[model samples]
Target: MKNKFLLLTWLLAVPLLWGGCDKPLFKTDEASIAQPDELPPITTTGEGTFACKINGVNWQRCGGGFLQSSIIGEWHPVYKIFSLQGLRSCEGFDDAVYINAFIDSIGLYPLEAGQYDDFNLECQDVLDQYFLLETADNWVEILNLNTDEFIVSGTFQCTLVHEGCGDTLFITDGRFDYDWAN
Candidate 1:
């Protein structure tokens, strides 16, 4: 009899317990804004040295100081028949940068010549796709590789197209030194 009474009491309270809250079940407000971080999804893998310069004096890479790790690695842009981005097959002084993927579907080789390419196209493809250079493209130089390898003292060139302004080619043809990460 006690168990039956207890069961009866529990059953009767369930409806009363859930009755008060009736705020249209659930809803989302599209107009109400969210945080900047909540606005658009920021890429996790979309990290790398995205450097740019209008003239050549002020050069900047992505990640700045806080997010610099993404851009710190041995990377080079190459042009095969089909064009392929290649990463250094050999590991750099720093082991943190891993060659996850290469950019080209087939390896880097001329369709007619069939000559072997130096760097692996697979690695370069991944970098190009991840770090897309949609603006007027230019030869990308491998500035520094870890603490040891650095580019030969030369200023690389780049092309830029400001949104409203047209296109501009930047020439760093002179010579420049690279400062490797300590």
Candidate 2:
């Protein structure tokens, strides 16, 4: 009888001894960046929308209260190429994407990773972590090229594997609109 009463008391007292968790705790593996539904639209007016999803997570280029974000590009008429880069800066991430042009037409081009000096799509996330094009599908297609205004607009998608690491990043719905200088 006494043991039964002691067990009941212990169970009742244990509930009171435990503290409450008012704050939310997240694990390192589960700590993913916040995602927003509204991404910048695809435009040819140099809106500079450098955004994509990383492993199904949102990645955007913006002035993250600290570092500034911008898009810089150039087109060489004689070389028949247009190159552009997206510099992204956000809280806890400084990402960048690069696309080097080869053809001067508004068409789809092969952008394979790990290849040397042709049409390529490359990205860097969290430093030393690069997008590998050899793993999955990757390409870039120019939708609009306004030579008069020097605006280059394109859409790109790639499956990037981490160099030296086994992690993968899916860069999807990627688009860019930048005013290039010759």
**Which numbered prediction scores highest in lDDT against the true structure?**
2
Clashing pairs in 1: 48-71, 49-71, 85-124, 86-124, 102-122, 102-123, 103-122, 103-125, 103-126
Error of 1 at 133 (Å): 10
Using all chains and alpha carbons, the TM-scores for the candidates as numbered come to 0.23, 0.66
lDDT of 1 at 24: 26
* lDDT tens digits, residue span 20-135, model 2: 54433432222365567766787877666666665676666765432456666676878876666666555444456666657577999766332111111233234454555664
Model 2 scores what on Cα lDDT? 0.63
Off by over 4 Å in 2: 1-33, 64-67, 112-131
Residue pairs that clash (backbone atoms under 3 angstroms), model 2:
none
On the 0 to 100 scale, the lDDT of residue 77 in model 1 is: 31
